[model samples]
Target: MARYARSERESLADLLLALGPDAPTIDEGWVARDLAAHLVIRDRRPDAGAGVILPPLRDYGERIRLAATRRPYPELVDQVRRPPWWSPVSNRLVDELTNTMEFYIHHEDLRRAQPDWQPRQLPAELQAALWRQVGPLARMSLRRVPGRLLVQSPGYGEFSAGSRGEVARLVGAPGELALFLFGRQRVARVQLVGSPALAERLRTARLGF
Candidate 1:
């Protein structure tokens, strides 16, 4: 079976290597080397990865990530390219579940950072897969927004988000909307419609994890 996660993982690895360690990425304050180390720590260190989402463990996660970032760049990128088979996050059974969207998002984080970057034509299946992810993600990420949030991915489908007040509709491909909702607004090509002020508010609102 085709695995988008693995394909993205390998592609991202190759890109990082070609760009070298000093290249820029969409992640603020992180260059390619920093992003590479993040990937490694995220998958190989379950304890540290939890810190990515768990506030109490954030300090520990940051400590481990800092150590990983200190390793030689090439070596760090290689580890991201070929994760150990026995690894909890990289093992076959869990890899797809844990990494599909993770890799996709980070891959774009690299791609969109470059000056000449352009959106790739994604396969229908992959778009659908991405659509599925942004559904729940939009709900959670936009929960704090003071208006009704509707995310529309043309041809695939759409989902409702936010809790109350005026309704704001966001239109774009799944990948684009996902990036926008995740705070990649500078790079994500999405259209926001509804109240002008509220729309701007949603656009400028601190989004993503």
Candidate 2:
């Protein structure tokens, strides 16, 4: 019943404002302002959002996103905080399913990019919610990874990905595993257990969408 998506969105907006527009984020070449613009475009601009996943619309999406960045930084963060009620992705009915992981991951993207940042002690319910998403994410991100990959979140569950070859295991809390699968491997606090070669391969493999 908790609206994790809303909470994460608000928290991320708060952090974005606190850090100012120039703060770095885990996303390459993007700063706090850029990330704020991205969130707004994602939430309010469905036509532009399509470019995020559709190759043909990419340039148009980039143009819209770049224009959004020209707005005042605080205004952009405010938009990220308060998505329009009619937003397709952030509407009350679908917001939880759609935005929970999206906001959580981006929240960490900003947090982990900062100096002296520490991992959060997430609520158990949120961890379970995140765990439920791990399997699908792993399947998509690791589909091309060589060898068998096992992802485990103690006290939650496990998921297997990749075709057979050597076996590799990724162990962490559900949130950490989610981060790893989302291509934040360098910042994700997960352990890889396998042959040295297998471990290295998993570590360096391009994971996430």
Candidate 3:
């Protein structure tokens, strides 16, 4: 027989519960507040058991950029569930698996504000997922720019370091690194990897909310 949820899916809720009150979040976009609202609102909807909010649930990446360019933070947070988010062009069907992704995605945003940034100790499965996403993204990022160091985000334990010994260091708790790699630390700090360049790329990169 099939179960409604698997161990992997069940772990995400445990992960969310593990997050502290002060995780990193987007600065101008009410990223944390919106995430909080999403968690609260979506969970309440009996129809959507897992409360998945995919990137597709958001505005076109372009639209989010345009909106970020024009809107005030107060208004932006207020608009969380309205337009763009629920719009057909962006919303994608998702379940708990996708829901877990959202938690990681949004948590990264929150990590920026947290200086003593720490990625919660992920269960083995989620830890594995974090490892999988970081390398490809980091390699692609380095090709476009330059950074001569590697860091192990806290909590997850050190998995890999591309190369070592640069003038600067990529340092932070595991969650912070995970969040930064995923592009949410734009509004927060990932401690530092090498230069302001790392943070700058994160800020300038056209990552959508």
Candidate 4:
């Protein structure tokens, strides 16, 4: 995890760069713009004429992204060691960990938008960084497969086999779930086995912006 403030803007930026210019273009835009704007919201960057704005996702992601961008990583760590941005008001380590998770989670999200997308396992170092989120993402990734809730991923396994209560399926590689939750995507492309209400709820979970 980070010892600095806010989310991982560098990592998010790196991921957008990795997505390349040829990636899928959503009705809103390509994954690149979506990813960038999402992080921008987390950082609370002044909305200086960036065309269309994105919906809100999680504040933590935006915060870290902006914090990371203003200075070099070394400087960021220094900021963490100083005052104003660090205190009981906010534990530096905890904030860094969440920001790390946001980065790791969203990396997968943007990556999954491509037909050729594939996720390397969450890197051990990054995992160590966002280690706390594994359990939480695992639980959140699960969908109630048979109960009118189904999660379908492109190349991954089918979750729940369309039976039983809630299903925590990992159908479309982990990366898909990462981007999906990060709100880089619209749910229309993803089929839901449950009621329209369930789909609506998932759509509106609002991962910040």
**Pick by lDDT: which candidate is best?**
2
Q: What's the CA error at residue 197 for candidate 1, in Å?
A: 2.1
- Residue 81, model 3: Cα distance from true site in angstroms: 12
Per-residue alpha-carbon lDDT of model 4 for 151-199, expressed as tens digits?
4444343333223554333234344444554454463233444456555
Candidate lDDT values, in order: 0.88, 0.92, 0.45, 0.43
Ranking by lDDT: 2, 1, 3, 4
Instruction: Tell how far residue 143 is off in model 4, in angstroms.
Output: 9.0
**Candidate 1 least-lDDT 10 residues:** 94-103
Best by TM-score: 2
- Give residue 94's lDDT in candidate 2 (0 to 100): 94
RMSD of each: 1.2, 1.1, 9.7, 9.2
The ten-residue window of minimal lDDT in model 4 covers: 43-52
Tens-place lDDT per residue, model 1, 1-209, is 77999999999999999999999998989999889998998878989988977999999998999899899998999999999888888899988777887898999999999998999998888877788889878887887878898888889887788987899889998888878888888888888889998888887888878
The residue-by-residue lDDT of candidate 2 on 1-209, one tens digit each, is: 79898899989989998999999999999999899999999999999998977999999999999999999988899899989999999999899888999999999999999999999999999999999888988998888888888888899988789888899899999899999988889999998999999888788888886
Q: Write out the backbone clash pairs for model 1.
A: none
Instruction: Give the candidates in order of TM-score, highest first.
Output: 2, 1, 3, 4
Q: TM-scores of the models, in the given order?
A: 0.95, 0.96, 0.41, 0.41
* lDDT digits (tens) for residues 1-67 of candidate 3: 2221233233433333345333334645554434444443443332332323354434443233443
